[model samples]
Target chain A: MNPADRALEDLFQEVGPERAPSHLHARILAQLADKAEIRTVPAPLLARWQWILIGLAAMGSILLAVMLPGNGSSTGWIALLMDHLPDMTSISSTLRTTLIGGAVISGILYVLDAQLNTRVRPTHG
Target chain B: MVYTVTHRILRNDMDAEEATQDTFLKAIRGLHTFQGGSRFSTWLYSVAYRTAISRSRLRRTEDRSLDEVEGRPGEPGSEAQGTTSDRRRALEHALSRLTPEDAAVVTFHYLHEMSVDEIVTATGLSASNVKVKLHRSRKKMLEILQEHLKEEVWTLRTE
Candidate 1:
């Protein structure tokens, strides 16, 4: 830029763009605070107790399933299917217990995932 | 910075203020979409410029009959009133008379000292377009100041 242009530009520096009103700054901060409040809140502890109770109920049900009589006394599809199939009586007891434990743990995880998704999940900036 | 950009483009406080608020909110909401390529401030100004321009366009389209009741937003010399210096007043008056985009471009270049590339990144305008706007706006403002001040001065004409 030439001297004239530089001088003209300098004049702009003497008086810059309009100053925003103080209320506008307060208003912006208020809105951001409102947003943080809405999004950053943690879920209540009562809901945490509910989740613990649910996990206990699932564990108790699994224990009941393991202790209950097998397909022998019942007449459902499993009983009929087991009647035709070769028995898992030949498998090791420890392996059968491990398989049952894995299935139960997977079911617990699925339920927990769904519950966590619907309820409070932490967020990052 | 965001407010100033919107203020120059919109030429009125209420709309410019609205646009400035909208720009920040939009930036917050859409921040995840921003890649790390540009500076955060540049990305922000990009959002601000687009929001202000779009709002300005919306205002124009909605008011096809025009809002003549207000009768021209703020006049050139009207805002320059309280300034302590005559030259500053003259420049403000001259800047106000340019097209809103040109005024904003000049303000970005002169007041903010933003480079042509930064302007292009912020405004989505081509580099040449920004250059042309700056060059023409500077020349035009100089003309306005010299002519206006010269005309206002008490002079004696020779025979």
Candidate 2:
């Protein structure tokens, strides 16, 4: 910048009020604490709505299967159906337990994604 | 320090205090992602600038209609009186009329005394952009001060 412009800007040095109120530092620190609290906040469990929906779906499916009329023969249609659905029954109980465990993991992930989305993205909030 | 920086931007003590708090909160939340690419002070200033800008924009938007009698938001304390105060107020009034980027240039250059390189790093603007902003802001400030002086002279003559 030119010397004249430099001098003009220098004039502003004497223009602003003195340092902002001292309590400002304490206030900022307090706010920082609040933010840390928010960031460290543990995520909430998955939505109760999701659990309710899954429960309702499972119950509805079970009722529908039981309510369906079956041939009244000695063929034991229910047993035959269960036998044909080998993929569901053949897995070790341990593997089945692991598959159920994945639901918990995915639920946590879903909740965390929702929380971060709401907090970080203003449009979503 | 946050308040000091924000006060420079907003020129309103209460608003500055609030903006300072918000800036620190934002900084804390994003602290994990703050790579050490720039000085901590510069990064902090950038955060403060953004917070203050957002707040003032919100205020302006909320009170959009000019007929709403937008009185100055805070009291003009004794701290903001005298020739020093008047000159500062004059500069501030003019500064408020400038764009946020322009006001930022004035603040960073004059109040912080940051060099061109420092400003470029702080604002993420190219050196040429910084120079252009600085030049334009300085010229605008000169015109503002001249108009202020002219008004003062006119007032004196009438008296």
Candidate 3:
């Protein structure tokens, strides 16, 4: 071997990582579990509080749908039906009541989702 | 196996056990994004390195001095190499003086037996940089050990 290579070999023998204490691996693994790729959400996603926001949005939509005159049975998309159906006075009262009930159920779903999320979150940032 | 990543981070056998658990927890969660390009161990090492560095930083800040200084075997000047333990200690002492980054490169190469290319992937350093660092770091370590050995010989002759 060249002098440089030989020197390197000798040096490696002196200050190599193998001499490091063994517990370092375990410490690293523990830290990783809490913070990195293994977690349910990425750090950025958790930071944004996206799950909470999504839950809130779902609840709001359900509320609007339930309180509307049509019983959420409108032919168009639920949001659009809720918006335009108010103009249709000819709709039956029974249909409107059913739609209102459905909206209430949706709102309940959102609340449940929010509660689940709150349970799963880390306590101390 | 004796020189594995796990042992390096936490010296206490118990502490090492806990750290290994933590490392796997972190690795499993991040497994999906791990491209198949690198060895699992290499990727794992990066995670381990980050974890170790963060802990070291925290410990330093809290204690106002590094606490992991006890395991070093002996000063490089000690030429007591008749025993395996002596040589090992000499190596550890010589390594302790290196900057953490240089120490890391040396470890990856020697302890893990990683190639320059593997180290490049693991450390995210350019291949040329790895070569340069490895070269310089090795040279410095050898010089330190040799100087110690020479001093020891001189002392023996004088005595």
Best by TM-score: 1
- Clashing residue pairs in candidate 1 are none
Which of the two, 2 or 3, has more DockQ?
2
DockQ scores of the candidates? 0.27, 0.19, 0.15
Q: After superposing candidate 1 on the true structure, give the runs of residues whose Cα lies further than 4 Å from its correct spot.
A: A35-70, A73-102, A118-125, B61-89, B149-159
Write model 2 residue lDDT over B1-159, tens digit each, in one string.
556556655656788888887877778777776789878888888888778877877776554464257754322334433366566666776676666667776788787777888777766778999988877777676665655644332132100
lDDT by residue (tens digit), candidate 2, A38-111: 42434445466876675565555543344233413314766566455444334445543564565555566666
What TM-score would chain A of each candidate receive against the reference chain A? 0.47, 0.32, 0.37
Residue-by-residue lDDT tens digits, candidate 3, A44-116: 3233356567557556655554555545444457666457544545654655566556656656765665565
lDDT of 1 by residue, B37-116 (tens): 77787788789888988887878755445545543443345333434455555665676678767887888788877889
Candidates ranked, most accurate by lDDT first: 1, 2, 3
lDDT for A35 (candidate 2): 48
Q: State in Å the error of residue B131, model 2.
A: 2.5
What digit string (tens of lDDT, one per residue) describes model 1 on residues A4-111? 656656667767767898899878777655553324444443465665776676676555344334524445764655567555554535544765676577576657
> Pick by lDDT: which candidate is best?
1
Location of the lowest summed lDDT over 10 successive residues in candidate 1 chain A: A36-45
lDDT of 3 by residue, B4-117 (tens): 454443333444455555556666666676897888888887776665545544554433333454434345444465354555555666666665556667778876778999
What TM-scores do the predictions have?
Answer: 0.69, 0.55, 0.51
